[model samples]
Target: MPSPYTVIEIFMTQYRCKRERNARKKFSNVF
Candidate 1:
């Protein structure tokens, strides 16, 4: 299995991508 840190890093990247996508949608709606 992967190390704990590796798992966290992957989770963080996916989470960040999702959050950025959501933020973009909100910004587009506002503009």
Candidate 2:
């Protein structure tokens, strides 16, 4: 089984990916 830390790390990476996508979308609208 995976450790707790590993699960948290995965979740964080996904969250950052989503944030980056949103930022890009907002930027495109401005430009």
Candidate 3:
């Protein structure tokens, strides 16, 4: 099994990627 910190890190990375994707979509829409 993975450690708690490792799991949290994975979750954070996924969340960051999602946020970046949304930001990119919004930026493209504005242009």
The clash count for each model shown is 0, 0, 0
The candidate, 1 or 2, that scores higher on TM-score is: 1
Steric clash count of candidate 2? 0
Q: Estimate each model's TM-score.
A: 0.92, 0.91, 0.96
Runs in model 3 lying further than 4 Å from the true structure? none
* Model 2: lowest-lDDT 10 consecutive positions: 1-10
lDDT (tens digit, per residue) of candidate 2 on 1-31: 8999999999999999999999999999999
Residue pairs in steric clash, candidate 3? Answer: none
Residue 6 of model 1, lDDT score: 100
| Whole-model Cα lDDT of every candidate shown, in order | 1.00, 0.99, 1.00
Q: Candidate 2: which pairs clash? A: none
lDDT of 1 by residue, 1-31 (tens): 9999999999999999999999999999999
lDDT of 3 by residue, 1-31 (tens): 9999999999999999999999999999999
Worst 10-residue lDDT window for candidate 3 reads 22-31
